[model samples]
Target: MAKQSSNRATQVIEAVGSFLRRCIGSILSAGPIPKHIAFIMDGNRRYAKKQNLEEGAGHRFGYSTLMNMLKYCYELDVKYVTIYAFSIENFKRRPEEVQSTMQLIQEKIEGLIEKESIVNRYGVRVHFIGNLKLLSKPVQLAAERAMNATWHNSKAVLSICIAYTSTDEIVNAVEESCKEKQKGNEKLLDEIGEGPLIDVADVEKHMYMAVAPDPDIIIRTSGETRLSNFLLWQSARSLLYSPGVLWPEIGFWHLVRAVLDFQKNYAYTEKKSKES
Candidate 1:
């Protein structure tokens, strides 16, 4: 009887704590919110192991957390949200885990297509950036479908990076630029007499995110401090937020705090030429 009472008390306390956190987050300062926010969702496997749960369960919970975070961002009027869903290096993990993750991705994509989910309701355009050919046919098809479905959306954008590496992305952009240049002018190479002189603007025009602005803030959960080869071209001037919470454990309050911190630190300087 005493043990039962103790368990009930603990549940009540947890409920109270969650309510308070949400209330605090909602009431937090109205400040300058980032126009674009990128996230490195990390530590799903570690979270699973710690909870003695299956790896699949951990990933499922992580997806739920992502959904909640998206809603929070929408409420805050953030124009763009990008997430590192999978990396090119992650393909080396055990076959079973890799398969499981692929399955999860398929499920999430299919889910987005049905009914009026947040993505549909909010008119959030979806973009996938990566070596898409490396993914299975179904996954690729789903990604294309999602992008098409949300193509008309103007309110917000969501970019998912799967099978992606910063170096690969840069190289791909450069190759594209070279091809375009060759197409534009057959004799331009001789005219310039250049030894591989590529301008930053030329490369930027060929990148996957050429249509979108660079992220104002990049947040990585699970205490990871490094960029881990995500967004190499675009994050040169981004504000990074590394929080200790695991991806699945992150909540609205955490996001609120990150944005608040960003507001405190952000600076905007007018260019001298622009000033004149």
Candidate 2:
């Protein structure tokens, strides 16, 4: 009898918490919503250690949190979301761990390909933005398939940065720009250049994230104060929010607080940009 009562009480608390979050979210939508939001989901490993779970369990838990977060963002009418899923630096970890992460990524990508998946239900266009060549061929294929499947979803856009690093992205843009210059019309180039000119415009045109504007707010979990090579160029004017909680532990309240913080300072942040 006592066990049943305890279980019922816990369920009631969870229900109340979810209700409050929805109410807060409704209020937040009244203001100007951020067009793009980037996330650095950190501290999965620490959470695993804290919980004394299997090494990879934290990442699994983080995945659920991420899925929920995505739903919340779309519900708030956020148009673009970029998540740092795998960094180039992650390859240095143990091979087994890297393989495990890749496997999980593959599973999630495949999940989105389901006919009734969230991507379809929410009208989210999915994009994988990074040096995809570094990913295993099967994973690459899965990613391409997912992107193709949701290419027409116009309500929201989800960009997953995997096997990526800012420095590598910059280098790739430069390389691609050079190739384009080589293929340019020589007669047209003669007036201004012996060789085709490659400027910031050229590079910007080739950047991986050229599909979306820069993020307005960047939230890094686990209280990490540094950018850590995530979205270096695109985050120039973004307000950084670091919450002191692990990735797996992030929930509706954390998102609400981040958005509220952003709303509190939106005017000033925009004004500073114009003055500069």
Name the top TM-score candidate: 2
1-276: candidate 2 lDDT, tens digit per residue: 999999999999978876876787788988878999999999999999999999889899999989889988887788999999999999999999999999999998999989888789889999998999999999999999999999999999999999999898899999999788767566556655575468888999999999889998899999998998988988888989899999988877787787888899999989988997
Candidate 1 Cα errors over 4 Å, as ranges: 1-30, 194-197, 268-276
Best by lDDT: 2
lDDT of 2 at 220: 94
Candidate 1 per-residue lDDT, tens place, 1-276, comes to 999999999999978866765565456535666888999999888889889997688889899999888987877788899999999999999989899899999889877766588888778989998889999999999999988888988899999999899898899999988888788688878877956646778899888776678888899998888999999789876778888988999987788778887776665411322453
Alpha-carbon lDDT, every model: 0.84, 0.90
lDDT of 1: 0.84
Backbone clash count, each prediction separately: 0, 0
Q: lDDT value for candidate 2?
A: 0.90
